[model samples]
Target: MLRGVTHHITATREDGTVFEVSYGYGARQRRLLACLHCDWEEQITYGGTRHKGLDHLAQAHGAVGNPTMTADARARRQVLWTMAICFLISAVILWWATSRT
Candidate 1:
């Protein structure tokens, strides 16, 4: 799952059997998909860096592992803020131009 982009990360035992973490802040749930003994697929939205949410997909129900195992949430908070700013700016400009005519 090292294809897209990396997110917030946490290291665990070297056994490679740790709980993987991925934030999936979908339009619905801010899910945290935690995979066990494996990786996950992720994507960056908005600011092209900050992530939307998290998804946790545990290996097995009550599997033995650590929460500090997940790789890392690469995106940052700035991304979201940046996106919000741009959107607000665009909205203001659109409203202003429309009201003029």
Candidate 2:
């Protein structure tokens, strides 16, 4: 029944991380490929190109603070980095204060 299906995707992880899973099926030899996402994960078989049902790790954990970042993702990483630095500083201060005798 998937003869008309083209490229497809079947997420392998679920964490509300990705926006969508790029999937499509083909009518040829019944092959499929998918760009996995956090909200969906499934097996697919149809006529298509290379494997795709895999995590888009680059978008999820790609480089941060690069001059190329120009969107919300960059903003999100900045906030997270700032928070991490603040937390580290706080931990060090706490250690020093408690160690003082």
Candidate 3:
């Protein structure tokens, strides 16, 4: 189920250190972010992947500020939000129907 290309990120620290990060629909089609440096990795189960990745970069690697969300991340977020809204509407409709009957 990975339907698109995986994003690869490179962050360089002020001390000239570099880190490699890869995130996307990874193994088992789960969204994940993994750092190639120092064993920092996370599976994005909730919230924003960009935020988590940026946090890791800033805190661990001394990266400056948060980086913009990649195109893939943005698209994924839109899809997730849309699905969530649709699910909420469905649940509401189900509740209303049940109450009416």
Candidate 4:
């Protein structure tokens, strides 16, 4: 089983054939971009997997669209943002309370 954050991208070609790509870390913690429709795969080295995956879809499969992140990844990002905001608010409140003394 894969163990890390995974984001999926899907695109449909002119013939209505759909292709999907997965961008995420593999079990060994290496970032990867893999196509579900073919044997194409790339080990991401510089964090441009999104563009690479989209390019593959358009150039190789003649598919184009605005790729979207998976709901789970989006939810995880939202949770992290919420936690950061909460931490900031709590820090401000603590500083204000301490400075009042």
Candidate 1 lDDT over residue span 14-89, tens digit each: 4532233444444344334333345544444344222222122322222233334332322323454687899999
Counted clashes in each candidate structure: 27, 20, 0, 0
- Quantify all predictions' global Cα lDDT against the true fold: 0.40, 0.43, 0.68, 0.75
- For 70-90, candidate 2 gives per-residue lDDT tens digits of 364445546768988999999
For model 1 the local lDDT of residue 92 reads: 100
- Tell me, by lDDT, which candidate is best: 4
Error of 2 at 61 (Å): 14
Off by over 4 Å in 2: 1-70
The TM-score between candidate 1 and the true structure equals 0.30
- Report the number of backbone clashes for model 4: 0
Ranking by lDDT: 4, 3, 2, 1
State, as a TM-score between 0 and 1, how close model 2 is to the true structure.
0.35
Q: What residue runs in model 1 are displaced by over 4 Å at the alpha carbon? A: 1-75
RMSD from true fold, candidate 3: 15.1
For candidate 2, the C-alpha RMSD (Å) to the true structure equals 12.1
Deviation of model 1 at 34, angstroms: 14
Candidate number of the best TM-score: 4
Clash list (residue pairs), candidate 4: none
lDDT by residue (tens digit), candidate 3, 19-86:
55677776778788887676886888987766677778878888643366355445555676898899
